[model samples]
Target: MTTRTPAAAVAALTLGLLLSSCALLDGSTGGDPTDAPSAQASERQRPTPPFVRQGRMSIEGGNDVTFELTVTGLEHDGEYLMLEVTHNYLEDLPGSVTGRNPPVRLVDPVSGEVLRFLHDPQSGDEPYGTHFVPGDPAMPTHEGLPTTLRRYFPAPTQDVDYLTLTGAGIGLVPGIPLTRVDAFTPAPEPNAHEYIDPETFAQEPELPDEIWYPDNPPPPGLDTADRRQTMESFVDGPTASTTRAGDQETIALHADEMFAFDDSEPTADAAQTIRAGAQTLRSHIGPRVEEITIVGHTDGVGSDTHNQTLSQERAEAARALLERELDGEFTLTIEGRGSAEPLATEGGPDDEQARARNRRVEFTYQVSPGADGSADTDGLASARRHVAEPAHFFDELEPVTTLIHDDVDLHVYPMVRDGAYAFQMVGLQNSTLSPLEADLDVDASAVPGGPAQYTQGTLGGFRVQEPDTGLIRYVVRIRTGDGEYEDFADRINELATGEQYLALAVFPAPAPDVTEMTLYAGAFGQVDVPVR
Candidate 1:
């Protein structure tokens, strides 16, 4: 699975933060205007910060199903203070010949209401390819916790404050299903240290050493013991409904329970005998049975490719026997898990027991008994309401102001000195008007560290820390705030921060009316620092 951008990474991290009983993460925002130490400094002291509230929900079913929710950005919207959240889920399969499709839905933690919203699963278009063949042992497999998905709403420019997510469809690979969805209030436009000129894609950074692309890798490690094996079901049955490739409605299957079979093989005869045993168990499968998965495994004794082939053959032989024994109109999908999992220590002294365990095949059942308790509507509802807001501290500060009109994407530039610094930005809304990108405007000024020119770019949001003794002399731009450019600069400058208080107030553009305030931020964009 492709690792999502850093912002989405934060969403996953947010869940970890919530699961831990940690105190809130805090940061200061605005700077003190006066340079001198005045007597009224006591009066200007900041107010106390609110305690960040957090909650969570975990649901499991046949073929491991888990979902988690984290609340991040919280702001008042009319009568209700809305919460920006990040949602994550995992689905692991145990047995079944067919891939399972788990449905996803969002529910209100308090009211138990299934929230609604426009879902765009195909928003980001990035084609990925690999050289490994389908059954290659070296190929990355999803046998243990395979399904990984992550989505980030950089800066929500729409009216989608409250969100509820549920598992809708998942394949029957006994792999972890991991997905993350997040929400946060917008800050000033982020200070970008790097720049990729649109004209030539020439990349430069106001801060050189701080910004560099990383060699992105898939986020899984299967080369270890203690690896869990998951199975996905595949059956060649006709679709219940007529639809395109991804539109067919077929029965979703998963192993209700699981047990491992392993033992070193004295030879090929032993392996065949164990497979025969598993086939005998197939006699238990009935018409209501949707599928059965016989995933084969090896002890990594040979080359990865060779071991994968051997594992696949073992799986096929077992599958063929079960299919012939079951004799049904149901579909069958077969594949190999290669040598991703081990049932025992490969080099243990009790080699006979180890070989027996490693060479043996166990059975798991996937029965479709109409709509039983597994489909308990109440259980599903209770599970959905288990959503909660996670704790966070908005530290490290940079602010930007943007002015948008009918046309022209007014951009912003960040100020910096010699070396390197990094930052992000988010847009904060001030009214009820729908957030429109066309109406957004941005800008930057008051750069520190001379003989030093700065470059500008657009990103999600910036970070802010409490202005303490040494933190001083900095500037930011309102990266992305859409609306008629009405007193935009004044509204941005009004942002305040101190020891305890962090206020995000917006001055309405001198206009006919003001409705709501929304915010946004850039995820990875950074800034520059002075070297000399």
Candidate 2:
């Protein structure tokens, strides 16, 4: 994933001082020293909430760096919501390591809206988040040092009181209280090695002038306020996948079921499958939906020309059947992407399954307005709701379900619901005396493809399934402006001996009435766990 930094001028002036020890404090007492002190004392006397969340950053070439994060404030200043987070590294953060600051998002689990850092409209939509300081971007960090960073986002609804802070590598920190303040404040500095706890702070801190104010409305023509979250559903038999972002729906059909052995022609059963897809289109089509695109892809097996021609013919064949099945007059576009885009790793233990998944035809179209994004059941009968019977349902999530595979222990934790998403944490520990390449045999080919192909050593394969509805929720994906997708999970390459690394996977929230759902942990099989 590419890290989008803020504009050079703004980044250098504001974020460049991330490692500096100088504090930007406001000395103003607001006309009464006693008044300010009394306000501070009253705030300190209030019950202290859990404001600090701790996590470890596993640096690829360096030792694991433990860090504590404190959400100093998430204030809505009318125009925008400003988020202030303090990063306290327990060890020296090597300057050589870039992207020290992972991407952070404020998710309203109830609303299921994920708010990303606002981008500078003037700077070609570069996100106003992490950036490299002037000179040697890879500067070393000091131990027990507290660095504060601020990001702006579109404000959420007034009813939203708490939000979950999710960082790529830092995992999910839920239940952060949101405050509606008249003004934003700067982060308070920690005294020596001691950290400043915002929950117990007396008076509101002041923010630097540079970051407190930003251009309003984000300029004309730039669509920066779109806050729709994408919801995905994997049907039973794992036959098809549907992704809904806003009103647009993209349905991906498994080619193995549509065709047979290097054949461009649809098989006997293909008609039913195509009709199901056409039904899906007809059900979702709205007045705004003018055209639907059908694209075909093949696995990395045949030559470029052969695969390209075959993919094109297969797409055309599907189009022919879809035209007859549909009752509406809509423009249809067909294209073939030979072996360029693959949803799974071609040469791995699950090579055959990956290839079969790669051979697919996708239909992208716009659905009717006001359509429910979280609707589980779709048009296909075989792809409709069904029951998922797990092997076991643990009464207590503690004693965390540990699945041993190849001398490695993979621990699955309980699922907790936060607003519109469910958060699950899994730990991978190396039990062998020697360092081992952790291979839990997690395959994400069953899901749709994205920027990472959803298989680059990521926990994207882990999913949560509702037993009654048979609705499978894969890891949530954030769609970038370039029409690419990035998973909301951690990516691990290897594990050290006896080292237990924790990874988090975020999924779409199940029906409110459904409390117990089955967790499908790739090679570990399935287990029912209570959703808190």
lDDT of 2: 0.57
Q: Scored by CA lDDT, what does every candidate get? A: 0.25, 0.57
Off by over 4 Å in 1: 1-21, 24-294, 301-313, 324-326, 333-532
Kindly provide the TM-score of model 2 when superposed on the true structure, using C-alpha atoms: 0.61
Best by TM-score: 2
Model 2 lDDT tens row, 1-532: 1122222111232221232211111111112111225645633333223355455554444345556666676777665677766666676543323243335567766544667666674555554543332221221233464555666777764366666666544455555556778766644332311221222212123322222222222332434466434434333335566655545667878888888979988998889887777766666679667899999999999899999998999999988988888755788899999999876667766677778878888888876753433343446532322121111111123424787777778776666665456777676777987767656577523343322343333577777777775656667776654566667776554565666666667776565567788887767667777765
For 488-529, candidate 1 gives per-residue lDDT tens digits of 011121111111111111110111111111222222222332
lDDT of 1: 0.25
Which model scores highest in lDDT? 2
Worst 10 residues of 1 by lDDT: 236-245
